[model samples]
Target: IPQFEDVKFEAASLLSELYCQENSVDTAKPLLRKAIQISQQTPYWHCRLLFQLAQLHTLEKDLVSACDLLGVGAEYARVVGSEYTRALFLLSKGMLLLMERKLQEVHPLLTLCGQIVENWQGNPIQKESLRVFFLVLQVTHYLDAGQVKSVKPCLKQLQQCIQTISTLHDDEILPSNPADLFHWLPKEHMCVLVYLVTVMHSMQAGYLEKAQKYTDKALMQLEKLKMLDCSPILSSFQVILLEHIIMCRLVTGHKATALQEISQVCQLCQQSPRLFSNHAAQLHTLLGLYCISVNCMDNAEAQFTTALRLTTHQELWAFIVTNLASVYIREGNRHQELYSLLERINPDHNFPVSSHCLRAAAFYIRGLFSFFQGRYNEAKRFLRETLKMSNAEDLNRLTACSLVLLGHIFYVLGNHRESNNMVVPAMQLASKIPDMSVQLWSSALLRDLNKACGNAMDAHEAAQMHQNFSQQLLQDHIEACSLPEHNLITWTDGPPPVQFQAQNGPTTSLASLL
Candidate 1:
C-alpha cells in the first residue's frame, strides 16, 4: 500500500510538471488537487501537495484560492502539531494578503506568527528561519505603509536573524519533525533578501547613496547565484532590484541609464510568461515615469492608463492615479478625468492608500492642481499639508517639490520675501536630492524673485544656475529620446514589443548612476 501511494504521488507530480512545462497550468491544477486529496493519509506529502497546488493557483493570479489553500494548510499543520510549518503556511498567506493590500488581515496574522516563532521550542535553524520570515513580513508591512522610522527595529532583527542562520550549520542536526525538514530559504538566498529589504528601506528614507551601495552588493550576490541556479525567484529579485535602481537613476538625472535598464527589465520578464504577467503593470508604470521625465505628456498618460488597467493592486493603483492626475494637471486639459481621479485618491475621503508618502504625494498633486487653476490660497493650504506630512516621514523629494511649488506660488503673488524664504531652502534640499527638475524650478523662482526684489547680482547667479540645469536636462532628454528602446512608450496592449524580446537575460553589472 505504501509503495502504491509513493508511485501515485510521483506520477501525479511528474505529470503536473509536464503539463506546467507545456503551459497547461489548468490541467496541472486538477492533477495536483487530486493528488492532494489522496495524500491525506501521509501528513508530510499532504502538506507538500497543498503547497504545490497553492503555488499553481498563485501563478495563475487566483490569489483567493491560493490564500484559502494556504489557510487550510496552516490548519492542517496545526492539527498535526507542527507549529513550525504552521507558521510557514500562515506567513505565506500573510504575504499574499499584503500583496492584495489587505493590511487589516495581515496585521493580526503576522502578530500570531511572531508569537509562535518566539514561543516554539523547535530546532534552532527552523526557529531562526521562522523568525526571519516573520520579521521580513513586519518590515515589508511597515515599508509599504511608508513608515521608514517604524521599520528600523524589525529590519535590524531581520538582519541579525539572517546572520544567526548563516552561522548555523544546516546539517548540524536534522530537524526532528518531518514538517520542519524544509527551509524557507537557504542562507545565501536569505542574505540577498535581507540586502534587498535594506535597500528598500534606505530608498524610502531618502538615503539614496546607501540604497545604491546595498543594491550593488545585493545584485552582485544575485548574479553569482544565477550562475549556479536559474530559479524564477532569483529573476524576480533581479527585476525588483532593477526597478528600484531605475527609479533612482531617474531621480539623480540619469535618464539614459534608466531607459536602458527599463529595456533590461522587459527582456528579463520576457523569458517567462508568468514573470511578464506579474510585472507588466510595474513595467508600464516605470515607462510612464520615464515618459514624464522626458516631457512626453501624451505617452506618459497612455502608459499610466495601461498600468492602471493592468493592475488591481490598491497601492499601485493609487500611485498611478496620482501620477496620471499630475500629467493631466500639467497639460491643463482633461479636467473631468483629473477631478475623478483626484476624488478617488483623496486622503480625506475613504483614501485607499496607507503609505504616508503616497498620501503626501496626493496632497502635492492637489496643491499643484489648485496652483494651476490660480487658486493660490487653496494651493498653499494643500502644499503646507504635504510639507508637514513629508517632513514628518523624511520624504525628501516630496518635501523639496512642495517647497519649490510653494515658492512659485509666492512669486506669482509678488511676495518676493516669502518666495525667497521658500525657494532658498527648496534649492538647497533639491541640490541634496539632486532632483534636477526641482532644482531647475527652484533656481528659476530664485532668479525671478531676486530680480523683482532688485537684487541684480543674486538674480544673475540664479540665472546662470538655471541655465546650467536647463542644458543638462535638455542633453539627457535628447539622449534618452534617441534610444532604440524609446519606442516602448507606444506599447500599451498585448504582449511586449517583439523587438525587445531576447533569447537571454541582460548582463547584471548595473553600476550606480548616482
Candidate 2:
C-alpha cells in the first residue's frame, strides 16, 4: 500500500509536468494540489510540491497565491530544520513582492533573508549559493531604485562570490542534509547571470559600450552552452540578453538590427508557451519602442496599449503609460486620455513606481506635455526636476532628453544664449551616447542658434551634421519597415506570428549585432 502511494505521488509530478508542457496549466494545478495533500507526510516531497505550485501561480501572475504558498513552504522548511530551503522560499517571496513594487514589505524580508544566509552553517557551496542569491537580490533592489552608485559594492561582492564558487569542486559532493542537496545553478550558468546583471547596471549608467561588451561575452557563452545542452534556462538567458542588446541598438542608432533581434525574441518565445506568456507584454513594449523610433505614432500607440493591457507589473505599467502619453502628446489629440495617464504616473503622487530612472522619466514626460501646451514656465519647472534626479543617478539618457527639450524651450522663448548653453552640452552628451534621435534634435538646434548669432561657418557645420543624422535615420527606418517582421507591431493577442519564426538559426548573429 505504501509503495502504491509512492507511485501515485511520482505519477502526479510527472503528469503535471506533461500537462504544463502542453500549456494545460489548468489541468496541472488540480493534480499538483492532490499530490501536495497526499505527500504531507514526506517533508521533502511536500516542500517540492509547494514550490512547484507556487511557481505555477507565479507564472500565471497570481502573486498573492504564490506568496502564500511560499510562506507555507518557508514555515515547513523551518519546521524541518532546513534553513537553506527556508532561505530559498523567503527569497522567492521577496522577488514577487519586489516585482509588485511593494518595497516596504520586501525590505524587511530581504533583511531577514540576509540574516539567514549569514547564520547558515551548512555546506560551504550552499552557503555561497545563498549568498549569491542574496547579493543578486540586493543589486537588483538598488538598480531598481536608480541607485547605480549604491549598487557597486554589492555587485563586486557578487562577482567575488561567483569567483569563489567557480574554484570549489562542490558539484559531486553529496550533502549529508537532504535539504542541502539542491544546487542553485551550475557554475557556468551563474557566471552568465552575473554577466547579465553587470550588463544591466552598465546600461542603466549609460555606459553603452560597456553594456555591449558584457552582452557579447554572455551571449557567446549562452550560444556555446545551448549547442551542448538544450536547457530551457539557456533559452531564457538568450531572450533576455537579446532584449537588453536590442535596446542598446535602438539607443545607438541600429534600428534595422534592433527590429531583427526583436523578431528573434518572438521566435524564441514561441517555442515555449510559458516563455510567451511571461514575455508577451515585454515583446509588445519593444515593438512600441521600434515604432516610436521610426515615427510610426499610430503603430506605437497600438503596441503600447496592448502591452498596458497584458502587464500586471506596476513599474512596467507606469513605464508603458508614460510612453503611451508621449505618443498621445505627439498625435495632438486624445488629450483626455493623456491627462489620465499622466495623473496615474505622477512621480510625486503614489502610483508605486520604485525605480529612480522611471520616476525621473515621468517628470520628463510631464515636462514634454507642458511644452506642447505652450506652458514654458511649467515645462521648465518639470524639466529642471528631471535634470536634478537624472544627474544624481547619472541617468545619461534621461539627462540628455531633458537637456535637449529645455534647450528647445529656451530657443522658443528667444533666449538664444541660454539655448546655446543647453543645446551645446546636450549635443556633446548625445554624441557620446550616440543616441541618433537626440543628436539629431541637438544638431538642428545648434544650427538654428549659430544662424541667429551670425556664425555662418558654425551654422553650416551644424547643418551638415544634422543632414547626415537625418539620412542615416531615414535609411534605417526604410530598412526596418521593409522587414516582414515589422508586421509584428500589429500583433496584439495570442501566440507570436508563425511567419516571424526563424526557420534557421537567428537571421543575425548576436555577436555581430552587439
- By summed lDDT, the worst window of 10 consecutive residues in model 1 runs over 505-514
Model 2 C-alpha RMSD to native: 3.9
TM-score of each: 0.92, 0.89
Clash numbers, per candidate: 0, 0
Alpha-carbon runs more than 4 Å astray in model 2: 1-12, 19-43, 500-514
Per-residue lDDT for 55 in model 1?
A: 86
lDDT of 2 by residue, 1-514 (tens): 7567668777888899899888899999999998998887776678888888998998888999999999988998898888999999999999899887778899899999999999999677889988998898899889888788678889999999999988887656676656555566777888899999998888888888888999999999998888888888888888888888888899988998999899889879878887888788889999998999888899999999999888987767877888899999999989999898898898878846678889999999999999999999999999999999999888888989999999999999999999988999999888887688899999999999999999999999999999999999889889888777788888888888865533355643344367
C-alpha lDDT of residue 36 in model 2: 90
Instruction: Flag clash pairs in model 2.
Output: none
Model 2 is weakest, by summed lDDT over 10 consecutive residues, at 501-510
Q: How do the residues 1-514 of candidate 1 rate in per-residue lDDT, one tens digit apiece?
A: 7578878887898899899999999899989999998898777778888888888888877899999999999998999888989999999999999887777898899889988889999778888888888898889888889887778888988998888998887666766666665678877888899999998888777677778899999999999999999888999998888888888888878899998899888888778887888899999999999999999999999999999999987778988999999999999979999889899989767778788988988999999999999999999999999999988878888889999999999889988888889999989988876778888999888888888889999999999999999999889999888777788999999877654432255423343232
Best by TM-score: 1
